[model samples]
Target: MNETLAHEDLPDGLGLRLKVDVTRPLTDLTAAVNALCDQVAERRATTVVVLELAATPVDFREWPGDVGIQAVNRWERAIRRLEKQAAVTVAVARGTCGGPALDLLLAADFRIGAPGLQLILPVNDGHFWPGMTLYRLVQHLGVARARRIVLWGADLTLDKAAELGLVDQVSEDLEEALHTAAVLTGRISDRETAVRRQLLLEAVSSEYEDALGVHLAACDRELRRLRRTRDASPQNLVGQAAS
Candidate 1:
């Protein structure tokens, strides 16, 4: 079951590699989601790359009874948890990415795609699956573009995805995308990254006055740390000794 999702520790524990096969069965996908949740819970200063393999669009209607429905719900929850918990989550799309793959991509903080990347959404019996994925698309791409993709059943090319801000980078080279992700991950400490992420999330629903306190608290922490560092510097120590 773990084989369905391979986990690799990046050099120097900078992040993790989560290779997922979206074509796998619901049970396998569930296992993969569980594994990802475990990794996120660690709250390390690590970047997570969700590398997707080839997969056809999944149709939830085809799943057997309530079990399939439950799996879909659980999978979505897992992605949401990852989005909120991981210090930095990046999704890399190569080849076809649809259904579960797209869901994971939307949940990531950043996305990188290959030149041949194609994003698809599954339509069940002529009706699109109305899910949280639609809300995510709207948030990232706005209502007009989200409608075009969700209602019109339009496929997204890598270039268009980047143009719409859905993807941060578009490259034919997989290694280039990975390098970019790693660099982005190293730009901040784990604690600061998490705090900033929370600030952004709160800003979406919080007024300026309401958000000021939290921001100021974060500022105070930064200021105090800086002061401490200055006090402990060699120059400060030497001055104190001379005095």
Candidate 2:
């Protein structure tokens, strides 16, 4: 049976939590990822939380056959599925992070890192390993910067990563960051938020003219609703105040 450490090790109130300690055996890592993905899919949680590299980095070379491939596939599928559902994922990082840690970060919508956070893009003896990491890096950073990171295996400090827009924030405190994220997401209605998110996604690969009409109509609808709600306020109080 696959055993997971108790959740008490991390801070509380995360909808669904996934913690990966690379110091654990490869078997345990794969089990944790699979279990986490299943829980996320089942709950359809609005947020997916990750605690990354809390221990020594596990050497991918030590993983047995099929474990590495399955682990990567599980994470890839979970991230894409969650993205389509208007769910946001956050990666909280500390210490030396590369390989699978970097890959998971790319899969997240937001990344929070500590002072020592360093990013290592995948490369084997000067040859870049072309995988989902490369694909996502290119999508976010464009071809030139992506190539530089991958080919040369550049290490990015937390401040440097923030400058490059790789991470949302770099702070010593993880609890505060989590609370901020919760507050930001809590104010918005889920359905409306999902609609807006889908529209933005469509706009990315869509032509301006084609998206303009739909975008305008959605905005106008919301505006009209707000105006009506505002105007429908009680007039008796206003008149009493005037008298």
Q: Report lDDT per candidate.
A: 0.72, 0.63
Cα lDDT tens digits, model 1, 29-61, are: 767766866875675555554445444554433
Predict model 1's lDDT versus the native: 0.72
Clashing pairs in 2: none
Q: What is the TM-score of each candidate against the true structure?
A: 0.82, 0.69
Model 1 residue 166 CA deviation in Å: 0.7
Q: Clash pairs of candidate 1?
A: none
Show how many residue pairs clash in every candidate, following the order shown: 0, 0
How much is 52 displaced in model 2, in angstroms? 4.2
RMSD of 1: 3.2
- The TM-score of predicted model 1 comes to 0.82
Q: Write the per-residue lDDT of candidate 2 for residues 105-201, one digit (tens) a residue.
A: 7766678888888776665545566667777777778788877876766778888888888888888887688667654653452445656766855
